[model samples]
Target chain A: MCGIVGLHLRDPALYPRLGELLTGMLCEMSERGADSAGVAVYGDPVWSPPGHATVTVIGAVPDLPDVTVISLGETHVVHAPVPVDALVAAIRAQLPDALIAGFGEELTVLKGVGHPRELAATFGLAKAQGWQGVGHTRMATESAVTPEGAHPYAVGPDQCLVHNGSFANHATIRRHLTARGVVFDSENDTEVGARYVASALADGRDIESALKSLCAEFDGFYTLLVSNRDSFAVVRDAIACKPAVIAETDAWVAMASEYRALVGLPGIEQARIYEPEPERIYAWTR
Target chain B: MDSMTIVMDKGVNRTLHRLDAGSVTITEPNGKHSVAVGLNAPLQVSIEGHCGYYAAGMNQLADVVINGNAGVGVAENMMSGSVRVNGNASQSAGATAHGGLLVITGDAAARCGISMKGVDIVVGGSIGHMSAFMAQAGRLVVRGDAGEALGDSIYEARLYVRGKVASLGADCIAKDMRDEHHAELRSLLAKAGYDDDPADYTRYGSARQLYHFHAGNEY
Candidate 1:
């Protein structure tokens, strides 16, 4: 069992408030699973891989983009949080041929292993300031925990997804995704779903249509939270083995594993909160 | 009686204090479990909200009151006293009990009072499947309909039904509610706070013909 929280705000200047909002929700969501935490943020220019350029995301970040081979994880992050354009340029510098194609906005993904507080610190997640951030706390029933095991997993640079509950027929689904050149990283059902979704949308399918296809094809108990630059989506599998609640207002939309987490947010008193029905897909504008 | 109040939260973990004949009321904001377990004395406990499984199991004390619905096995093995549920109860409400009384105000799910010794369970609503399965002793009173295989292998315990009996267990048969039986029903109902007339119910028990079973005697 794990818990996921996704927040979308109409106000981006209020992005700094996410440090507090995500931290609070992660605390309560810790009950679902306490192993790890992670979050993905959408800023101003969405980074896209160059169509013909050689795209190689080293396991760590490195020094020079074309000549030097950076380990898959270590890229020089801007210590002082800068504006959206600078952040996007810093990201593009990593992959010389990468362009701003899909999400015409800046995005930040921070995740790591350990408890929510611990992982949040390791990745400097709560230190981040942005709007429309999604986070997850893992319990580690199906997948083993590792640096790659933390959630809000990025299927690609833009597509990130988190989930709760067992995903049945994972082996069969994994085989298909791998065949489609969607690389599998951690041995998690959610990772398979994330990769499949990103590849599908990249292959020219709308977000809703791709998600519906995944729902129709996959069998399991899951409440999935997915997001990109301009929008967010939520879908639950046929059987609701896990619980997910959403609190919405004109000001913002926040989702968590339980009702207690939504107790006192801005507009919370006037917010309409509800548990998402089993097997329904809900997508909204960012 | 003014029972002692123990405010329990995350700070209190493992090893619940037993209460014997002592009256206590619990207002658990966390909605915890094992409130009053493994007690030897006759204590009465009133839980304010929904309780997790096994509320007053293996009781040797007095009565307990659950203000809300109970999870599985409200009284697992009752040695004595009584357990009263103000709301519904889940499967195996009283399984393998030797003594005491269990009163459920609402419906009870499957397998209520399986393998009874000398206890009495009174449910005001319908019971789910496999209730009274292998009940050895005591009495089960259901005011509503019984599900499939009502008493799979019933023993000497008496079963009273106010509604339809879908099916009966092995060695069990619908019995005539004689004068002595009616008096027993009246006493129990009165004790459980039921003001309904006695004649509305029917009693079911072992034919006693299977008290010493032969393979040929079972159906």
Candidate 2:
């Protein structure tokens, strides 16, 4: 079992409170999964400055040749004036064994192996300001209880995926992706799903179609919350055993595994709240 | 018969369990699991906000009202009395319940009344897929539509759906709504405080095909 929460803001005025609200949602779900936690924040100026490429890595990579590295708790953020591909290649050459938590133009991913609340405090998540944020608390069902096994697996540029249930056919799909030369970071099932969606998105499929393809191919119960630079989407398996509730208002769109994670949101009493149906992709594009 | 208000916190269920007969109000439920659960007294509970899993589970001789939405397995394994949800209910509403009436005024998510033994569930809005799976005995009344695979492998349970049924499960077929069924449905609707016409519904039950093992049946 895992806890997944995401917030996509529509009004620019609410962006400053994005992290504060997301922290509350994430902490509320700590009871669902308390072993490890991760988060992906989009449009954070301090973490991922505009007009610069940023890559978040978790390892002992003290100094890179050209880029600036800032340490935030257990994860490290690398910023370079070069493009994303260049920075990624340079980082790969320098820290070959380092795990790239996230890499994008406007996204920064932070994850660790600890209680979600403590990790949030260590990362100073409440002070973060972003337009979109997705947080996950992991119970270590498919993988070990380490930072590497934590969720919000950002496999693609500016894309993040968090899952609440296991994938039964992940090994088969992992083999399929491996045959097509998709290197994996961990043995986690959610990584396989993230990699599949990333590959589909790379193949020019939209977020909705990519998730629909996932529903068609993957087997097992799942409630997935995926986000990119411009869109936030949610989908469930055909059976939809995993729980997911979504609430939307004019200012923002929020999703969590339970309703308690959403109680502290602004205008929540007036929000249109409902559970996402099985195998139906609900996407909100900015 | 004293009236009191209890803010939800740890060990609150124990306090509630100690109450024999009183009117208790639970505020700030905050989606906590097992709220007001396992009540055996003649008490009245009113939860002021949304609840998490198994809210009012194993209820007996209590009238519990949730003013907000209920999470998974609301009123599961209920013995007697009634549980009412003013908002939508999450998955497996009244699952494995033996008796009592469960009223969901809004839509119920997947697997409503799954494996129900003898509960009476009334859903004011639609129910999601795989509802009433392996139901041994019960009465389920859905005022709105039902999702796919309703009453799969059901046994003896009567289903009354007022609106569309996406598909019926295996061995579950539509039956003629007789006069007795209309009367029963009318009584059920009245109990659940609904005024819908009984003739607007269709009854479904097991065809008994899976009841007996057949040599030709493939695994």
Candidate 3:
């Protein structure tokens, strides 16, 4: 089992407290998964500065000649005044063995193999300021408990996906994608799901359509929260064995594996809270 | 009878267990799992806020109420007594329960009474897909609509739905609502504090087609 939490702000007044709110939500779900944790922050000025592309590498890349590198615990954030594709290519060429955790124009992904609360402190997540954030705590059902196996798989440009349930037909789908030349980063089943959604989004389908395609092709129990620079979407499988609760107020929209993670949000008492129905896509946009 | 308030923390269930008879109010539940499970004595318990998984599991001779929403398996494997949820319930609300009356005033997610041996579940709002899958015995009554594949592979347990049924599951067929079935539905609804008419309901039960294996039904 795993835990997934995400926050999308509708009121700009709450932007400064994004990380603080998300940290509480993430830590409350520590009991769901304690093996590893990962988080993705969107529109953070310090983490993803304007007009500068960012690529997060999992391990130490001692020699990346001409880029600003910021080390946060186990992951390294590399910033350069170039396009996202160019920076990713450069990092891949220089550090052949380095794993590119995330890459986007307005996103920063940090991951580690440890307790979520400790990792949140190490990453200074409470001090982060952003418009959107997504976090995951994994119990390692499909892959090993390594930094590379953590979730919030940011495959496409500025897109991130986190899952709470395992995929039953991921191996078959992975072979299908592999036959079509889609390279994978890890053996984790969630990565396969992320890659599939990323490919669908690349083909110009909207987030809702992409997730619908995923539900059609993939067979499993899953509650997915996929986000990009502008949109946040949540979807569950047909059976919907995995639980998800969504609470929305005029100021923000939040989702988690359980309602406890959302009790700390502002105006929670008055918020419209409900569980997302099976096979339905609930999406919010900036 | 003594009345006291207890803030939920570690050993809260044990504290509730120690009480032989009293009215206890649980505050700040904060979605904690197994809040008042395994009760053997007659007690009146009320949870003021939302609860996590299995709030009153294995309850017997206790009347527990949740003022807010309940997470998965609210009263799983209950042997006796009553549990009520004022708000919605997640999946498997009364799974594998042998005896009791579980009431949900709001919608219940998937698998409302899975494998229920002999319990009575009444939902005020809709229920999600695959509810009452393989239910052995008991009665499940829904005031609102039922989702896809309701009562799949069901056994002796009777189902009464007042609203639209998206579809029926395999081996679960609609039966004529006899006078006795109507009386049973009315009693169950009254027990759940609903005024809905039993005449507006439909009954469903197992077809007994899959009870024994046959080569003709093989895939």
Candidate achieving higher lDDT, 1 or 2: 2
| A1-286: candidate 3 lDDT, tens digit per residue | 8999999999999999999999999999999999999999998888788999999998877967878888898788898889999999999989989899899999999988999999999999999999999999988888999987998899899999999999999999999999989999899999999999998888899999999899999998899999998999999999899989999999999999998899899999888889999999999999
Q: After superposition, how far is residue A251 of candidate 1 from its true place, in Å?
A: 6.0
Model 2 / residue B81 / CA error / Å:
0.6
- Order the candidates by lDDT, highest first: 2, 3, 1
| lDDT (10s digit) by residue, model 3, range B29-81 | 98888889999888999999999999899999999999999999999999999
- DockQ (Cα-based) for each candidate: 0.07, 0.86, 0.73
Residue A254 of model 1, lDDT score: 85
What lDDT does the true structure give each of the candidates? 0.70, 0.94, 0.93
Query: On lDDT, who's better, 2 or 3?
Result: 2
* Chain B TM for prediction 2: 0.98
Report lDDT (Cα) of residue A29, candidate 1. 72
Tens digits of per-residue lDDT for model 1 on A1-286?
Answer: 7888888887666676776777767766776788777666665122112221112231344454332221213322222233334444555666554322212234556566667776665545555566677888888877777656667667554667888877788889899878876666678877778878888888888888989988898888788998876778888865444656677988888887654455546767567655454456788876
Task: Provide i-RMS per model in Å.
Answer: 6.9, 0.7, 0.8
**DockQ value for model 3:** 0.73
Writing each residue's lDDT as its tens digit, candidate 2 over B156-209 gives 999999999999999999999999999999999999999899999999999999
User: What is the C-alpha local distance difference test score of candidate 3?
Assistant: 0.93
